[model samples]
Target chain A: MGLIPRTIHDIDTPAAVVDLDLVRRNIQALQTYLDGTPVHIRPHVKTHKTPQIALMQIAAGAPGVTSAKVGEAEAMVAGGVHDVLIANQVVGPAKISRLCALAQNARITVAVDDARNVQDLSAAAVAAGVTIGVVVEIEVGMKRCGVAAGAPAVTLAQTVAAAPGLDLVGLMGYEGHTVAIEDHAERAAAARGALGRVIETKALCEAAGLNIREVTGGGTNTFDITSKIDGWTELQCGTYATMDAGFRPHSGHMFESAFWILASVISRPATDRVVLDAGRKAVSFEPGGTPIIEDPSGLEIESLSEEHAKVSLTSQNPDLQPGQKVRITPWHGCTTFNLHDTVYVVQDDEVVDVWSIAGRGKFT
Target chain B: MGLIPRTIHDIDTPAAVVDLDLVRRNIQALQTYLDGTPVHIRPHVKTHKTPQIALMQIAAGAPGVTSAKVGEAEAMVAGGVHDVLIANQVVGPAKISRLCALAQNARITVAVDDARNVQDLSAAAVAAGVTIGVVVEIEVGMKRCGVAAGAPAVTLAQTVAAAPGLDLVGLMGYEGHTVAIEDHAERAAAARGALGRVIETKALCEAAGLNIREVTGGGTNTFDITSKIDGWTELQCGTYATMDAGFRPHSGHMFESAFWILASVISRPATDRVVLDAGRKAVSFEPGGTPIIEDPSGLEIESLSEEHAKVSLTSQNPDLQPGQKVRITPWHGCTTFNLHDTVYVVQDDEVVDVWSIAGRGKFT
Candidate 1:
């Protein structure tokens, strides 16, 4: 009656919708890119917490899944993923014990930057009667975690090898600072430079007489750049499955926007201004900007509250009214993914499937 | 022994914790302030979605709860809060149907800015054989929703009164723009000026043969200011129960911060730099600021990424290390509250209870 959705007429507003075709295309494109490469693609499950999607990625070509937290790894296993790698550091006994228990049903791997955390994880795995794979994380550019390159990383690898129930597998290095560069040439150069350091650290690990098996790193931002680089056994890319608006300004591979927020206009106060029901809680405003409405020039975004986004009309060609459904490309895919509980997988105008955000808020 | 919490020490990192004592104190203090006023206090449940805290507010003198979405209203009703007022616009037939259903079980009321929405709501309520209270939302200073001041609001009120199964309860005017003023006198004067516009709108509605039962307005930022204003029968203060750092710079009421994020340091990469396992997903980067580390000079927060917070130590006296627990006072309470699933209610050093964030992400 008022430009309402013909197929998704009954579903609630402020819902996350995934275009199935776009998602498949994205997954297939990335797989096609890595088809002949020596590196494997281990998709990070943080972007889409659904095990169904994880299974889909695995069926496509993923060897295993990457997790950010132990709870997320547990949820992924619960969702049917068996081999999981927690790419972030796992500290303390509680989380380590949980990780060991998860290893009972699946092959578990974790990253380590601290020797004490390595010892703790090894002890927990030994008590649980399981062996856990360990990866020494080397700091390239992102100063958040991981040991410094060279001697420090070598020492951490030695610690992992000495610990019982823990097998030193490889090293991980995240080039987070260089991944978001807008310039294609600059970003590629920066990625290669940062990854050069990671490669040096891998050489250091090899020199230390550790039989390194796998090397994992990279994100959706540096997916293409790292794919061309040698020595990384597996690349962890999460946001490629559902590209965000933040990547548009710096996309080298040109992944299509696969995920969008479907929201209904709930209030139209003036002819010039209308308010949508999706805001910070429903849609995330991260990676430095607000989302782009499906038609970029249609509505002007005024401000966003916790539960509302106010937009002013810039043109009158397609006048917006209350009850009209619109789509928005999220600014950051991972942050947007964490905000929702379920995602409606759509094909054409109708909802084809619904997937629970199995790992949403699994912030252990 | 290796930094493993025996009890809650195992309950992952970066969790929201609420002090029940502070909740009670904030509720009592607000009630005491409203005790002398002519207006009633209806604590908005948006701050703390837990039914236990809402029940606490009710026990402390709240008549009902103000919800931003229908899902929150449903959760409050499920938690035994019978009288609920959704202080935002409720649009669409599907949402209106849900509102009608909730109305049958409880005394449900809503705010309206558009006449068509009022008609839709009225039709749905009539079909459901339940009466719904309608409040014409008046556009105060911060205009996200609601009709323009005098005649526009009067027309919406007339529409509500003329529609079957609808009662024109009162008006809702949110002074969001003036609520965050730093100076007490300026904030109070601005709130009074905004409330005066709402009062004039109420009078206009009355002159048009519509009855005004209640006039609700104000937020935690301007609770005291609006309480002293004339013609406001009820004040809706959401953030008073759990104070935030945004109010600290310009607090008119100085409500003690009850809500905090308990995080574990997972990485201490450098002597000067440490990383806490809380970030935008754990603690929201809203209202344009980072969270205040419980002790101001202990650790200086550098930045918050998707799942990690990089902090630099300011003082070496209280040495910060990995796996040490620290509390953070979030900059904005409402946005931060929507990011978690559970809130650990701690009294002292130990967690006494756990409250499910029932209304978190209830963006209908």
Candidate 2:
């Protein structure tokens, strides 16, 4: 049997390729780390945005899944996944209505840091005659969302406790801002510092006699550090299952390279420079850079446009032909995955499955 | 009735807001600029990727439409667009098959810079029993794609002519590298210099007795400059309809603010800063910056994360509290539009229509 069922030329260039064995191994490793720990694994679905991946994670002992948008949660529920947490606040009537509707089938929880949002959630849940779980988001150094560590977070938790149609589930804080620190020691130190604040806030909530069933936070980069937090009931890591070039430097675990963009060199008119078929439209630009060329020794991707990538070779490699195929390991796999509609799941180089990112383009 | 619809709040937060009046005016202005010229208009659909917007451009006197992917062409065809140009090269079996299938129904044209691509196109066309229109892409200023300008381009044109199942329709070149120059006079001067090389290649092809009917190039930033080129026959401008924050400084015509991200302030623990509900997931970061705050009083967007946007407010505006709504104009409208599934079309305070970005997530 062929190691790769399809040759590089057989598949379309600029397509998102996922190594199935790597994804399975990543899941197994993460599960192994959390073994005998109280922390439940609730992997974030926002990374893959595919229900198939969510089911796989659940099968590997994940308690549930988390999504960034209500539309994504709804899609996951429709795909037969029962539990989902909209880890961000859902504002406006349209999104609130959708959230209420989603609660009819699945266990839906949302994070809120402000009291006004509590009112909105309560009203929406009351109108729908369904109770929605609300998690008080405490600021954990991201400085992006959530209330400050102590009194402010306690006030929000109190409001959630008093809200008629809302259930005060627990306290949640995301140390996302410190996840991708280039220095491994510094990243782990910052993760502990940030999660420590959330632990303090959880203590305050417990003192107020609040029922804190779950405390969730953590991303792919800080999953190892977050697993050691005393009060964190769940780790919400997403990008671990599909390792990217950007995460490799910060990740503490042995994450297999799972995602690659297959592209072909379309132009090689100059001796030093070449161009590929994939560019900003095919991949993403979050890391403010282009993908690393997997072949062509000493070549570096210099720049990218909407439909083409320019690669400059430092030394001559006779095997680097004009039409040769190469795989690009993107810097950020989550954003790159969001750019595509379908991903080919390959096991042992054969495309075992073609899964749709069904919840993609649900930004609203 | 209010000029701006009230349904804006009900539609969805972080939704794309397009000003129809502004879009119509932009189309009319571009059409007026090319009034007495022989150059035809073929707006690139990769920017909008919506059939409704493509139809509007065609109705505004565009000769045809252009796209970067076969999936985009297929979506446009389903939306009733007949003349479509896949302005990028299609490689590998899957994409070539789709490109050939698109040619079965529409007047399909594609860019070819490689001799092997010509053979691939010919094989696909012959297999489908269709004649695909081929354009010899010439490198002007953007080093990303296209064969080199003089004899190399002529050689590719000759190859296209010799191909049995392809027609040598025209030539295409994109000076995208120079489009973002902040200085107006310098931008026009740079565009003229680069396009001069492209025009020279066209002349060489003509002297060799090749039938070069249409010569297309230019994006929204350089539409006016490229339209004035003597040998250029068509303009492929796409971003004119929905001008982005980045293009505002370059565009001569004032297209009303069409797109905005409506985000609610979710946290305001500090008097100097506030966090918004919309973050990196809802916006495009390809421009390598945060969204421009629509408020005129100098509220700076500090930073962005996966689900939060930190805004720094002026000391004078300390009263800006949590739960208040704010509008954010993204740096790149094209990528932002692709991030969402449905965009609301509003008129006089109501949602007049909802258009699905059908070609979204078609990265393969």
TM-score of each: 0.96, 0.93
Compose the digit string of candidate 2's lDDT tens values, residues B1-364: 0133457666556666766667788888788888888877898888778899899888989878999888788899999999998888776666778888888899999998889889989988998999999998887877667789999999999999999889999898888878989887899999989888888998899999999998988988888788888988988888887777888778874555576777777677566678777776677776555578885446778877666788876666645665577778888887787777766776665667778887775654
Q: Write the per-residue lDDT of candidate 1 for residues B277-360, one digit (tens) a residue.
A: 888888888646778888534666789987898887655636777788878899888888888988887775566877788998
- Per-residue error (Å), model 1, residue A146: 1.0
Q: Give the DockQ of candidate 1.
A: 0.75
For model 1, what is the alpha-carbon lDDT of residue A203? Answer: 83
Off by over 4 Å in 1: A1-6, A295-297, B1-11, B295-297, B314-317
The sequence of per-residue lDDT tens digits that candidate 2 reaches over residues A99-189 is: 8888998899999877887998998899899989989888787666678888888888999999989999898888888986888789889
**Segments of candidate 2 deviating more than 4 angstroms:** A1-9, A295-299, A321-323, B1-6, B295-297, B318-323
DockQ, candidate 2, comes to: 0.51
What C-alpha lDDT, on a 0 to 100 scale, does residue A188 get in candidate 2? 87
